[model samples]
Target: MTFVVPVHQQGQQQTTSEVGILNNDLSLEREGALGLLERRRNEVVNRDLNTSTTAVQRNQEENGDDENAKKKQQRSQCSRGCKKDWLGDGWCDSACNTEACGFDEGDCLGWCSGDCKPSWEGDGYCDAACYVAACNWDRGDCSRWREQGVDAVERRALQQKLRQFQQHRLQLPECKCERRLLVNGSCTPECNVPECLFDGGECLDMCNAKCSKSWLGDGDCDRECDTPECAYDKGDCASTTNATLQAMRKENGTLEVCDSTCRLWMIGNGVCDKQCNNAACGYDNGDCDNITAVVEIDYSVEPEAVYQFCAKEWIGDGHCDANCYNKPSRWDGGDCEGTEFEVEQAAKGIGPQYDQ
Candidate 1:
């Protein structure tokens, strides 16, 4: 019988034609090769597109990362009398619990019983480890912290201090130190000042004055202090040694300082002039509420500084004659005495003002 197939139908039949038994494997291989060729062509196109987009996309991603980092940093600081939140409980305290007492239910747990600042608590910036810092104490078991591996003299000194503190504990009007039967003295194992036996004669003060650096007079008490360039209002004395915070020994209540400079106190109204040398300070608003105000200044001399006024009483802001006097530069001829000012730096030219 003769087959009468249409042309389109014939082409369909050819496309759907079955392969011979062994040819099935061959057909699959052939299809795979063709698919591989098409895939290679698509891969070439995709590779070009990927290369073109790589740099731009990478830059965009980097910019996004930087922005994220900046935001994270801003949120990280503890500004509201608290910290950036505790990792577990998210609570903050004023002093940062210098001893990050590992607390569970508001009770000190773990190894330390007292206010032992744990090594991992707070920011851990105060992680003194075995050293045992009182202010910024963190990290490690404070129980193990002590002047260890010392000879007879060193060990005896520690024992002496323990005895002294024990005696001191007895005299406390309040906060009484209870003696535990097992312990020898108060502050059972406290990290008190070192009273080691030093060797040789060392300096007492800078000028061989009172109070040697030596705790035991052996000469090894190393307490080198910083010499202050100027004095603060604390007493106007020249602070030759570096003590963190206190008044100078220069004088008491003189409007003028030996160096005519004042240290910044967070709780006071007295302040210093920040030199306009800071580029960031030029257009800056000098808006200060008591706390954020800048009063402690690094002393500098300039044109405007000469004519500056420290207070209403002070003739000028620390710039005047060596005698700490100033003649009226633009006298309206009013018979008024010159005002006294704190003298950080006295101006030059003692000659009378001819203009006056």
Candidate 2:
């Protein structure tokens, strides 16, 4: 039988055990190759990380050095400031280091003999030798000395002329409305306003008389203020002189008259019902008290308003029972009416509340 099998045929007829052994060898080789590739990748990644970290650290160190250098330069500059100033003791640094609120060049020039003035570059009064541009030079005291030193009489004349010129130039709008300004937690104006029938401020127009300003502060004004509510007056308003509001029904009709002292109600009426329960009434207000609001009047008539009762049925507003009051009011005597009541009665009982 002595038969020798061909190599190709032997390979084709390989047993299961042989096939398993070859597969194991191939897997081992594959694993070894993969391990080598992973090792190379890890080395490259580590090298990149080290390079990046070194670059970052170097940049941070350089930034720190630059910051230090800048601070050193600033210090040197400040040292020179001490010699530059008149006192020769101050650093170049201004009062406000933060340029946002920095001072002007002549801010700390010398000791201010009078009121400390703002820098020469600001808009304020120059109480010191150096100060900012004085914006108020358009008129007033500065106007007289606009060019040079002048005598008092000449200066006064120049100031008056300048003021007149400015007034002529600045005219009020046709719409007569009051304007307001802010100052010292209060809305005060720039000029002195006298008291008349208006507040102590400059009148916008010639519609009202100029008030005599005795007080410097601001107050309400109404040129035609016939009653308590002070209407807005374009002109300067004046404070009340006597601290008493005089109201009267007119001479012919029952309309309130001005000749008599301020009265509350007409006597000849039905169901007189008057009450005092408001803040101004001095009746029951928690905070307001019954202080004697005395008023000086010229009329020789015996005061009757201080002791009269309210005519309930004759009250201007039908709701007078709830609001109309009569207390011992010095101004109106006894029959003092509230603002609402006054307006209603003045309009002959025609008002919002009465209509409603």
Candidate 3:
């Protein structure tokens, strides 16, 4: 018996197997087709793995380049003395030294010299030497030493000796003079001198006087007034003279003995009469009666004729009035009370002048 078979093409065709399926039995054809499908699937999986590996390697290379660039930037910043944390990891301590730190040289030197502490040792004693040198330089005539015009080598040697002396002085327990005290490794001038002097004299005694009448007699003596009169006059002579005059006047006019006789009829003795009513004298022999007199006043309003005399020598009279407009009917008397529209119309001489 002869059999006819149909072939179906679905996708791209694969290479033909050495063992052909054309003349093969039904089971052999099925096995060949299965093997070809498995081989295509394996090729696809291997290609994907290779592509993924290449991508991972590229990413790693890029990451390494970024890290190297960051390190270079950090080094550049460190060179500029702008490192955020000088003591942190990867930071160079040499970049933050006295000369390279970009801070105040004196302050940085002092810090590096360990002058910030109460006591120092070895190289730390440099600040103390600087401090003593500064004190002696301030107090002594350093200009004299410069005037010698020593050579550069000798000058440098002398400077080194002075520095050494300063350091040695700093190592001492205490400064001999208060002015020698070092502030930031420099001496401060003494400032305890008195500004003014107090001399023991009469003026000083008068200045301390506590008498109440001193203000009226003589004022307190001071540097401005070093005399006795300044304290004795309590400063006011006019008021004291006026008070003395007033006392004399009161005694002579009001407190005098009355030698006049009383005119009262009911009095037993006209000598000691206490009911005297005379205007010239209110007392009889010595005692005076305390009687007060009342005076009456009238407060009535009366009309009086007021005569206004106008000068007949009129010079500029009626001159201003003739030119001035006193009545509203006059043209120059300003616009009469009217609405804004009417005023505007009158200003332009429209609509009957609006009564103004």
In order, candidate lDDTs are 0.31, 0.32, 0.32
Query: Listing every candidate in turn, what is its Cα RMSD in Å to the true structure after a full C-alpha superposition?
Result: 21.9, 21.1, 43.8
* Candidate 1 structure lDDT: 0.31
- Displacement of residue 173 (Cα, Å) in model 2 is 45
Better of 1 and 3 by lDDT: 3
RMSD of 1: 21.9
lDDT for each residue of candidate 3 in 188-303, tens digit (9 for 90 to 100): 21111111001111121222233221132232322222212222132333343344435534655632333233222212111223333333233322222321221111112211
Per-model TM-score on C-alpha atoms = 0.17, 0.25, 0.21
Off by over 4 Å in 2: 1-17, 80-92, 95-356
**Candidate 1 lDDT tens digits, 86-118:** 322422222233333222223333423222323
